[model samples]
Target: MRKTAIIVGELKSRYSVGRALQQNERTGYI
Candidate 1:
C-alpha cells in the first residue's frame, strides 16, 4: 500500500513537470 502511494506521487510529479515543460516550449522557452 505504501509503495503504491509513493509510485503514484512520483508519477504525478513527473507528469506535472512534463506539462510545465511543454507549456514553456509553446511559449518559446525551449
Candidate 2:
C-alpha cells in the first residue's frame, strides 16, 4: 500500500511538471 501511494505521488508530480513545462513553452514561443 505504501509503495502504491508513492508511485501515485510521483506520477502526479510528474504530470504537473509536464503541464507546467507545456505552459512555459507556450508563453516562451509566443
Candidate 3:
C-alpha cells in the first residue's frame, strides 16, 4: 500500500510537469 501511494504521487507530479511544459510550449509558439 505504501509503495502504491508513492507511485501514485510520482505519477501525479510527472503529469503536472508534463502538462505545464506543454502549455508553455503552446503559449510560446502561438
Best by TM-score: 1
| Runs with alpha carbons beyond 4 Å of true place in candidate 1 | none
Backbone N/Cα/C clashes per model: 0, 0, 0
> For every candidate structure, what is the RMSD over all alpha carbons to the true structure, in angstroms?
0.8, 2.3, 2.5
Estimate, for each residue in 1-30, the C-alpha lDDT of model 2 and write its tens digit. Answer: 999999999999999999999998989962
lDDT per residue as tens, model 3, 1-30: 999999999999999999999998989953
Per-residue lDDT for 1-30 in model 1, tens only? Answer: 999999999999999999999999999987
How many pairs of residues in model 3 come into backbone collision?
0
Task: Kindly report the root-mean-square deviation of model 3 from the true structure over all alpha carbons.
Answer: 2.5
Task: In model 2, state the lDDT of residue 1.
Answer: 100
TM-score of predicted model 2? 0.88
Positional deviation of residue 14's Cα in model 2 after best superposition, in angstroms:
0.4
